[model samples]
Target: MELSQKRFVTIICTYIRAVNGVYGGAAHDAHVWSLSNERQYMPSNYQNGDKSSWLIGDSGYPLEPWLLAPYRNAEENSLESLHNEKFTKAKSIIERVFGILKSRFRLQYAPKKVVKILNVCCALHNICLIYNVEAPTVIEINEERSNLALPNVDQNEFSRIAQTIRDRIKISLRS
Candidate 1:
């Protein structure tokens, strides 16, 4: 019997800063472990009892009051499924942003070049989006390359709060 190749995974999280109530800058991904352990990127409203504000994340992230994820085992035509649909639509915006970034910058494929060139590319990317500039046609990058397994994280107080909020969203979607 032959052994198959073993693969390693790295998690990337994007940080978007708000200025004048408008989102600015291109998205940047931090390694998952760092995001799991750090608090610097957390928004002020997250800790100030602002229940209305939340982020849409995938199953890779733990449920938190400020982060909504799709429900496990959501059945077809159910409220959970509907919630997941809306959540996915919101998530697709991020996906499209990355697709545009990679399509415009060839250097993005090289890991060492990413940090040095990413900021500039992201700034240009935002500019393109603002002016509705058409991106040059290029070979499509594989979007599923980073489809890694979810990281292991213990459920905590924030996760419970996030789940509670997800439930509320589902209920609202039902009616």
Candidate 2:
């Protein structure tokens, strides 16, 4: 799902599975879906090094030429620290969007027909956004599930290219 930081709106959503699904299951791995689905239509501008249009995501997301993720590990006062701070601030907007979803739709305990219900909720959310309806003041809380083991993504040519892009981004941030 995509969220607009400026508008507090859900920009795009693709249902994979319920929150109860296995952490590393095909439906739950963000990187897998991203590679197969969203990566296909990445714009030529981003591919040609236009950072302005890139997507920013958390560590759970794979670092790609068109996606920016915070540094995984960094020393105090390091460039990575500054990058991570900025990245986290930007990502927090999505976190609030999720909270709004849970509050307005009770997504955590959504009953049978999970995907269908979630999709409907997302559509309704967008409608509410369009109408400028006030979001529920009481945001629901959902604990994050445990981290899953890394999936066996192949370290092939694309991975190498993505890594190179990430390295350049890190260096640029440092400078």
Candidate 3:
């Protein structure tokens, strides 16, 4: 579900999955941002090479990436470590939630029967809270899931943009 303001309440009874992290249900709000917009806004506040800027987070739960601007001026050594620790710990709940959905609820795998798919997804969803079993890897992502490694994008343009973002951030810190 696409939310404009806040997503504290959007995490119930939905797929709870994120795709490319652009648009998704539930936990996606933490890291979701339009590069189109952020590219314009963040540069003014944060230097591109500022690794700290990458951590500016509005996740509410303290587990998400710190929003670039805030992260730039944070306690990099200790706070980053603490934030990472908390983020790792907090992510387990989401993982378990997906695990239950896939294993007990059987949502991860595709249903073969056309007539009973809805019924099955619904029934399993209810029973899942009680059964809580191993996640059944039912639905496998196609080329879509593994695209990060393949790099189908235009290398030159992508590199140029990345370098620009990096250079700009780096230059900002010198002042």
Candidate 2 lDDT at 33 equals 37
Q: Residue-wise lDDT of candidate 1 within 1-175, one digit each (tens)?
A: 0000001112122322211101111222223322332333444567765667666555645456665667767999998899988877776655555455557776535444454555666667667767889876764433332233433324466766667788887899866
Tell me which of candidates 1 and 3 scores higher on TM-score: 1
lDDT of 3: 0.35
TM-scores of all candidate predictions against the true structure: 0.67, 0.64, 0.30
Candidate 3 displacement at residue 10 in angstroms: 8.0
lDDT of 2 by residue, 5-79 (tens): 111112333221112222223343353435443455554656676644566655655555566555666788886
Q: For candidate 2, give the lDDT of residue 12.
A: 35
Ten-residue stretch with the least lDDT total in model 3: 141-150
Stretches of model 3 off by over 4 angstroms after superposition: 1-76, 108-175
Candidate 1 Cα lDDT to native? 0.51
Candidate 1: lDDT of 133? Answer: 90
Top candidate on lDDT is 2
Pairs clashing within candidate 2: none
| Full ranking by lDDT | 2, 1, 3
Better structure of 2 and 3 per lDDT = 2
Q: lDDT score, residue 30, model 1?
A: 21
lDDT of 3 by residue, 1-175 (tens): 1111122211222343222222333333433443334434445544454434432222231211223111222365555444444544444444444445435444333223322353445455556545764455553321111111212225545334543553455445445
